[model samples]
Target: MLKLVMMNDALRNGDAHLKNFGLVYDDVMRPRLSPVYDVLTTQVWFPQEVPALAMQKTDPRGTEKWLDQLELERLASLSHCHNVDIVQMQAQCREIALQSMATTLDECPKCPPRKALEHALKIIEGALPVPSSSAKT
Candidate 1:
């Protein structure tokens, strides 16, 4: 899941952070990937207190310099490559998050976190299908 997010162009831009991830555990106490949360786009907002740099008029390259100085390789890669599919995945993740927010409760007394996770699992289970070839004939 970390790898997926690392490769994701939308997340690469600036959204990847500790707040965006979570974890879940099964009945037998096995930990697994949890529903994504707090997914959003981020932009480099230049500080109002800082003065903008002056560069040569013919070679105005402040943006490139800023990006390099800030180590924004992830953003650079996404901007330079074919990231349409990653964008689609990010959209799907956002939809899932919206659906969860609209329908899920913040707290459930009966089953607590486990039951809530089960509910989320049901929502995404269709995406993971059993292999037909492995089924008993």
Candidate 2:
């Protein structure tokens, strides 16, 4: 759940809401988070899109609202993770997003132009909360 929230913020996917998440059953009938799906860069189209059903509220009259360090901290606390964990997760999500989006932009034929997607990726990257390299667990 933590990773999903972080990834949604990192990828600037404004369509991630409770309904988008589901539980998948294991062989023992234990349920776990289903693989993330329906992810769309709604901000690329709407530009003013805020996170869907995020914990924090966005100002109606304001521009796009993004999760920041404080929100990350709050999420971490709720998930029982340390600050260092959030930092590492954020870095991992950013790296994964960059690589995956690169492949997507290169291979997707029906998708928008590479340049436009690249611009959108830049916006997503810009919104990530920068973690300190020197921070330790």
Of the candidates shown, which would achieve the greatest lDDT relative to the real structure?
2
Query: Distance (Å) between predicted and true CA of 88, model 2?
Result: 1.5
lDDT of 1: 0.38
Tens-digit lDDT track of model 2 for 4-61: 8888888788888899999888855778989889986677777777887657434455
Q: What is the lDDT of residue 114 in candidate 1?
A: 53
Model 1 residue-pair collision total: 0
Give the Cα error of residue 33 in candidate 1, in Å: 1.0
Model 1 C-alpha lDDT per residue in residues 39-59, reported as the tens digit of each score: 432222211111122212223
Local distance difference test scores for all models: 0.38, 0.76
C-alpha displacement of 90 in model 1, angstroms? 12
Residue 71 lDDT in model 1? 30
Clashes of each: 0, 0
Native-to-model Cα distance after best TM-score fit, residue 60 in candidate 1, in Å: 28
lDDT of 1 at 122: 43
The segments of candidate 1 whose C-alpha lies over 4 angstroms from its true place after superposition are 7-9, 44-137
Residue pairs clashing in model 2 are none
